[model samples]
Target: MTLRLAFMGTPDFAARSLAEIAAAGHEVVHVFTQPPRRRGRGQSEQKTPVHQLAEVLGIPVSTPASFRDPDVIAHFASLDLDLAAVVAYGQILPQAALYAPRMGCLNLHASLLPRWRGAAPIQRAIMAGDTMTGVQLQQMEAGLDTGPILLSETVRIKDSDTAASLHDRLMEAGALMWPRALAALERGSLEAVSQSSDGVTYARKISSDEARIDWSRSAEELSNHVRGLSPFPGAWFEMPGEKRPVRVKVLLAEPVSGEAAAGPGTVIEGLTVACGEGALRLVRLQREGKGAMDAATFLNGNSLPAGTVLD
Candidate 1:
């Protein structure tokens, strides 16, 4: 009972699900992804990971700038797809295209639906210090992620969990759950539960403005912020008394119990910084355009003596 599916996705997160769908013996009739855009230092065009993978698998790839065009809509309708699965697909699917598939569209969302239901859900959940989050398979509607849930699996958020780590775990979870969901769909046993209106939260996309570290917050809060943005658009602060306000990105840190009277943003012991509530011991950090290094390694090369406040 292999279902005919049209796969739509772009990034690594989406690619994993696409691979899982193909492995499950489904006929992936077409793949709709955003057109290649200029990227990197050379500003050369780079095809999306899903686009390249779909090409390798010999599946038809479509990169329509807009589905409003009648010709593009005609091509989509020509596929006569049973279902379409979308995961982190950058573009918005039009209402006309939504009904093109027989069984409608299903989305593999990264967060527990009705909570963190927009872009950057994984990072938002971590940054908000949520204790638990999960992946959900939903019936895609016109509204932004406001759809009925078809399947979900919860995962605990550890104190040490970072965005990168949680993202990997969720991807694996999605891969495992998607096949079961599809099997249920084939048997006409898939249940769709309406999402609760309460507990709804939007995960706005991360911005460069939000990356600047504000030392006035609690150590735990700051630690979560640092971890959530780690390995990309890192949480950073400028060193005081430096000629050019050198930015130091905090890659890893741990909260420690301390009652020092040091002011906020003040570097207490060269490695630890006093927060409004507690202190955090920085483990790994990096300078602008430099590779990440351990706290000791960073100190050896670039000295930040004790009491040298950060801004």
Candidate 2:
């Protein structure tokens, strides 16, 4: 069925889903995304992934910072949208905007409902060392991700899954499940169960302060932290050197057996760094303003003596 959908999203993950919906022959009447902002070294105006994708798809785009304006609400209502499909739209929908669409709004959330139900679900799930995580399509309510689940599918959290890898996987899975969800909705057979109040937790946005690696943490916990923030806002440690302290991002790491002889944060052997318990072998890392490299290459280029302790 060709449903009139107003695609409301901002990021690359949302763009992927929007593309899939269009490919499935949905009538994407209007695209709603955040306004372009200054980015990169140039600090020039940069369009969001969804904005770029919407332009390529030839869909009309709106970048209202908020839906509080009556004019904006009127414009939204004028679209006569059958449904509003939201994925990381980065704004709360007002009551007027939510009720404007005939079929109401549906959100593609990156985590299992009632668990990690906020902004940074993907990163939080990995950081928490969750054994399982999944995508959920929910009937959007006023509260943050506190909605009834229309459709959901679980994915196993692999030991080596970083935030970037897990994000891509979840995005693909959610896209695949979109058609099924729409079909159920169209058939009037979609069943939305209320999210359980138990095990409720918020996946707060990652902070720059929290990205600093704490060597006092256990090896397993430290490894989780490194992978959780991999590729963006990377978890890092300062390596004290002769000239200055070199800030290095730990992109990939694994917990290994080792004794903490020279206290925590000591470079035991290779890229293995002793923690409060066990040790973490850094597999991939990046120096400040440099490309990512393996432990050997990093060691060869940047001297990391065994007894050297990272500050």
Candidate 3:
């Protein structure tokens, strides 16, 4: 039997779970998403991914600015929802809203829990050189991702994984958990397990300045840092040019064992820069205002010969 549910989410990551819920034959009573905001180069008002999907699905959508309003909380409670499924919903649900559903709110958090608990778990996990990370289905509480885990699926962090690659992988992994969780919930078989107090780490939001490449760090650490912020707010470094310093983003790289007389940010050979400890072979790069290209393709048009110093 299907449960009467309300879905709350934002962004593409959250949209996947919403689709799965509808596909699972649950009666989605409503959808709550963040309000539209101006974004992009033109700064035009754009609806969130969840908001757009709910429209196409023919489900009623609510874009409440805040759940703090008495009317907002009352409206949600009025849904008479058996349960509410939340994923990557930006806002914090108030205590009243948390208990509005019959079974309270169940969230799909993109982390193993108690570890990497905060705004940017996916990025932070890769940045911190973590060898593992996963998505957990948590029972929502008033605290920030402090809820007990009802279910979890682990995904390995490959050396080649960037935030973008790992994000898609985790999303696919998370989609499978939703059906299993909801079905178990309907069967009265789901269980919640509290997170361990140890190994707790906060994944604070990524800042603009933090994305700048620091060449002085070890090659291995620098590779992780570049992968963590890749493809968006990309890890960038400046290259010395005749006219001015040209900014280049390292989209992909690998830490290699080697030694060079040159210091960090110097091109030792073939797009490989000597780090404070080893060397990094930049596999992919993008110059400002140019499309991303492999190091070979980038070298064909531009020049970053050996002995060249990068800022």
TM-scores of the models, in the order given:
0.96, 0.96, 0.95
- Consecutive 10-residue window with the lowest summed lDDT within model 2: 256-265
Residue 71 lDDT (model 1):
93
- Give me the overall lDDT of model 1: 0.90
Summarize candidate 2's per-residue lDDT along 1-311 as a digit string, tens digits: 68898999999899999989899888999999999999988999999999999999999999998878899899999999999999999998998898899989999999998999899999999999998999999998889999899999999999989999999999999988888888787899999899999999999989988999999899999989998999888999999866889889999999987666758899987889899998889999999999999988998888787988886
The TM-score measured for candidate 3 stands at: 0.95
- Which residue pairs in candidate 3 collide? none
Stretches off by above 4 angstroms in model 1 are none
| Each candidate's clash count | 0, 0, 0
Q: How close is candidate 1 to the true structure, as a TM-score?
A: 0.96
Mark the 10 consecutive residues where model 1 has the least summed lDDT: 238-247
lDDT of each: 0.90, 0.91, 0.91
Off by over 4 Å in 2: none
- Candidate 3 local Cα displacement, residue 129, angstroms: 1.7
Residue lDDT tens for model 1, 147-257? 899999999988888889999999999878889999999999999999999999999989988988888899999999999998777889987534788888998998878
